[model samples]
Target: MTPAIYSPDEIARRIALFERIRHPHKLLSEIHRALNIVRAEVNQSRADMVEFAKQNPGMTIKPSPLPLICVIGPSGTAKSHVIKTYYEDVCRTENWQVGRRAVFDFELSVDANKRQFHVDALTALKDPDPEKGNESVLRRRFGKLTDKLGTELGLCDEVQHFIASDTGKRTKSVIDAMKKTLNTGICALGLFGTQKAADIFDASEEFGQRAHIRFDLKGGNPDVADDRALFVAFLKTFKTEIEKMGILISTKTLEDAETIGCLFLQASGRLGLCQRIMKAALRVALESGATTLLPVHFAVAIDRGKLLFGIKENHFASHAEAFAD
Candidate 1:
């Protein structure tokens, strides 16, 4: 799903809906009428820092290195989406327009390594010559380019692959290369990775040290009241949105609290997974020409994500009865 930016009134209406939904179909339509923005501390913090970095070019970079923010979490945790949304929004600001390529977001492939990392970085910066020189020369040129282009911030997603393949220190050198370029006191880094990303950072102590501010989006805990509430809200909004899209859901398992808790557990508290399964279920239902989505459709969706769902089959089996109701 696309990250959404909402108006103040939309935000207010969303909040009201969050408290209680009078009309599932209507609220779902509202959710689709445009994406809504939920103000979280992490989003605001990133926005503020980026804005400040753009406003005062030399102060922060000089006083200390452009701080790095590493968002570590599991797949479907919205790690990249959150930062990507923030970067895209900030880049559209007037301050960011003076230098078109000042901010960028790029994803790393599963096999990305040192050279490829630099190549990708250069490309993300929109550099004309990504392969012009050796590592050292390339880094220097990169620094000069950023200094020239007024580059400020960068986002690198799925950096775990780089860490996983750095057995011979090739990938570690990539960080060293990046540090050299970052000496220009511009272009702070935002790195997104999964739990394995821990090993990536630990592999390069210097890179780990540079990541001063770390934001982690752990899976929502159903045992925790706050987490439970958040999960419920997420589920309700999702259900409403689906209904609004014309898939009449006959399964109250999604609407009930206890049953939904089991679902959250089955999905391992990842909204992305939950959303994906729902979409898949809807697709199956629509394909079959069914007028409504049922528990069986959801079961197939859940089973498709078996290895990743992280739920016990017996426990999930118990929920099947409730899912049918």
Candidate 2:
């Protein structure tokens, strides 16, 4: 049920608040710096190409293979979100346009074959007829399109979909297509997926060498003091953001140590899961006409989210004092 107090505009504002509460993590900064390095390399390559063209008119110049980064992580760590956020920030700040489409992003289809993969890549490139070509034709078109679009970076999510659950020959074909794109020097590649996505590099040593910058996005560990502090700080920040949206959360709602422990346990130290549970609890509380957030709301949220969250035990309900002093 929609809360009576929440108009459509207010609901959108609250959602925006929740979505934008991204914690500034070290990985974010690292990826940003690494992409800057890639941009620099790409700029140098383009400069070299221009100089060569001026020196030798009417000559074909084949660009060298560019850099590649693989961002592998478990589910609920928001790897895709992190990569997309970086690109979005860069494009917005630099006022990038179609002629400067700094990044092209797309997700691989489940069990994606070479044909489907190229079609998806072309679709991301805004091809007028992504479906109008054979696999070989599509592959060449995608390469040309990337060059025409001035794509400096390519972000592919769910990369495991192509590499996993495929025959050896099929896997190599798709991986080769990916390699071909990079070899053309049209764009640097940032592949994001679950740990299984690492299989792409394992299958091809050359791919691994090109993608030397690998980041394993680890979730928090409640047992570690530093990690626990980080999660607690994130929860506090979440509380502040929600309050700014006029959610009327109690001071102790997410600030108390016991509550923090409950959340950590519920989410298995995944900040993404914590955010999900908190958002669900807010919906429950608002629909029930609660003026302030409470543990009971979270208990309900856990119960509702159990099927997907897979927590056998509802920590908020059964043992609220599990982390009490």
The per-model lDDT (C-alpha) reads 0.60, 0.77
Q: For each candidate, give its TM-score against the true structure.
A: 0.68, 0.89
Report the poorest 10 consecutive residues by lDDT, candidate 2: 316-325
Best by TM-score: 2
For candidate 1, the per-residue lDDT at 39 reads: 17
Instruction: Please write out the lDDT profile of model 2 over residues 1-325, one tens digit for every residue.
Output: 4435766566555656667766776667888788778877877887898999999999977887888888888887778777767866676688766565777789998888889888888888888999897988997888688777777888889988876554567678778888887777757788899988888877888778887488887778867988888888888887877777666555367887778888888887877777788888877766665557778778888887888876688888853343131
Candidate with the greatest lDDT versus the true structure: 2
Q: Report lDDT (Cα) of residue 146, candidate 2.
A: 73
- Candidate 1: where is the Cα deviation over 4 Å? 1-64, 87-99, 144-149, 165-168, 245-253, 305-325
Off by over 4 Å in 2: 1-13, 57-61, 249-251, 319-325
Question: Can you give the lDDT of residue 194 in candidate 1?
Answer: 89
For model 1, how does the per-residue alpha-carbon lDDT over 148-172 read when each residue is reduced to its tens digit? 7755566778877766552647567
